[model samples]
Target chain A: MDLVNVISYSLFAIGSFFLVVAAIGIVRLPDFYTRMHAAGKSDTLGQSLILLGLIIHEGASFISIKIFFIILFIFIANPTATHAVAKAAFLSELAPWKKDGGKER
Target chain B: MFLQVALVIVFSSIIALYRAISGPTIYDRVLAVNVIGTKTVLVLVLVEFIYERPEFLDIALVYAIINFIGTIAFLKYIEKGGLT
Candidate 1:
């Protein structure tokens, strides 16, 4: 309808697209590391974009402030969690998927 | 509208859930679960707008905290082979 609503809806659509990409990636990727790459990076961007759209819709308010905190937390925590999982998998000696039929060096 | 966005997110989450169920390794399942949790947060926010309930934002915030903590805890247990 208005400029703000158009912007917000476009942002929401973009975020949803990223979310779908991440989901498909997790399902289709060859290995755990790649899946984490998909999940961590795209998920963060998707959630941030979606939250940003909602914030814009809400304008300046206490609710938007809380949404900002959620975005901040996700920006900090999502990568950390992904790294933690990858580190644990590495430490546990989980093998990375290699294209060749030989062991990875 | 927000409801359509939420519907798409729910569909994607179901796809993620498939990976969680049939993943080749435990880490894949973990990654899928984390992905789903993040999507759930977005869905929760969209639902708040759909229902015109500002208060549910608090629930979304809390869920984000719990999701992060849960992932970290799961990684720790997986790495050390124990929660302690």
Candidate 2:
């Protein structure tokens, strides 16, 4: 494969790895607060990296242009959504998961 | 390559679905939906490339917008028990 192809594919692989890892975290993590870490940063980074790879592959096309905007919007929008969800959960007085035998905190 | 990634993501989304269904609280379900939304956007983009159809990009962008707005609105309603 060409050098550009190699780089893009490697990026794609790494990005997908992170994406799957984060999903597993969402499934396996013990708490909503803990799952936020998995859902927020890692997911955004993985999606961005994959889109970045696509940009490298497309190279100055309209597709790349649209992808760039999508990445920008996602970076801006996801954190806002995550924060809103967390805040709403907190405000509702949802109990945080306990470590010392799942008893009331 | 796009197909493989798409399949993996679809699988990941399915795993996330387990949490959505059995989650101890609404926040977990909302979080799961958010995760699934991200997956949906990426899959749309990948499908565009895989099928050589450019129009899917616009759909992907629109989906992203709607997902963000929907999540925010849902949180607001949940937090205050009203849209106000």
Q: Which candidate leads the pack in lDDT?
A: 2
lDDT of 2 by residue, A5-76 (tens): 999999999998889898899988888888999999999998999989888988998899999999999999
| lDDT of every model, 2 decimals | 0.88, 0.90
Of the candidates shown, which would achieve the greatest TM-score relative to the real structure? 2
Model 1 chain A: ten consecutive residues of lowest lDDT: A96-105
Q: What residue runs in model 2 are displaced by over 4 Å at the alpha carbon?
A: A103-105
- lDDT per residue (tens digit) for residues A21-57 in model 1: 9889888887788788888899899989989998998
Question: What clash count goes with each model?
Answer: 0, 0
Where model 1 places Cα greater than 4 Å from the true spot, the runs are A102-105
Q: What lDDT does model 1 reach? A: 0.88
TM-score: model 2 vs. ground truth: 0.95
Query: Docking quality tier of candidate 2?
Result: medium
What TM-score would you give candidate 1 relative to the actual structure? 0.95
